[model samples]
Target: MKTYFPYQLKYVGVLFVFIAIVLSCIGNVDEFMRGLLAGRNDFETSILNEEATKVDQTLAYQPYFSEKEKDNYLKISLILSLSGFILYLFSKEKSEDEFYQQLRAKCLTQALLVTWLFTGLIYWIRPTYQLNGFYILQLHLIFFTIIYVYNKKWKFGTE
Candidate 1:
């Protein structure tokens, strides 16, 4: 298949993935802070005390607190990372050719097979663990990218 995006799009993909990672970090930290706060109920059982949630007002609870914001960060980050992954997948190398196309196809197939095996192992070891289809696809995409990058154009830049 013909590449739809220019090599420059890889930069955009990198940016998106970076942003997604940052957002995910922020979300996890927020959840952790909330848990820590919630756990510090002082010498009482009530959590409505000012000392519980007055930690300089975290990024997630600024201005007002809403339950919706708790989950939105995760969803937004996932969407952004997925978008970035797709852009990077379709973007062309500076020197794309038939050989590169065949290599890409082979890498993707290998990634899929490896992902399936990994998923199966995970399930077999931890039957309680659950993975969604989207997560599986995301894992496959990551495997494909890593394989393709190392195989085709891994380099230590001096610039």
Candidate 2:
């Protein structure tokens, strides 16, 4: 079968990574602003009162993103990360042979394994409250790192 991603797709993957990073940074800044603003007594009291009766029953003092803003960033970041992953995964190799195909499969499997294990470890160690906004942010980084390491180790079909 023919490869779906051309050799040029590697560049697209890189571009997606850049976009993800920028969007992630903006999300982080928004989070920081929320936290900073929440420190005010009036905002803190209002938030606590508003959230105390919610079903979550957790801390009522936590910072929250505006729904629209959070959803926009989440959707954009997810799309960018997924696009980057697909491009990186299917991009044509220099020598698209049986060995390269085997290596690609191996790498993909290993990456999934590593990502799942790492996520499990984090979940085991960290509180759910602490994991809120950071989960998606870390997921993209983990995926990129795994793919990058495998590509570097295999020299991306250079063998």
Q: 146, model 1: CA deviation in Å?
A: 0.7
> Whole-model Cα lDDT per candidate?
0.77, 0.66
Candidate 1 wrongly placed segments (more than 4 Å):
34-67, 154-159
- What would the per-residue lDDT of candidate 2 be over residues 1-159, giving only the tens digit for each residue? 345788889789878968987886776676676465546544546767765445233323453556688778877976797777667667887767776567666665666677677777887887483454545445644674577555856666444
Query: Cα miss at 116, model 2 (Å)?
Result: 2.1
lDDT of 1 by residue, 10-70 (tens): 9999899999999887767756665665555443335445653543343234322245774
In angstroms, how far off is 89's CA in candidate 1? 1.8
Model 1: lDDT equals 0.77
Which candidate number maximizes lDDT? Answer: 1
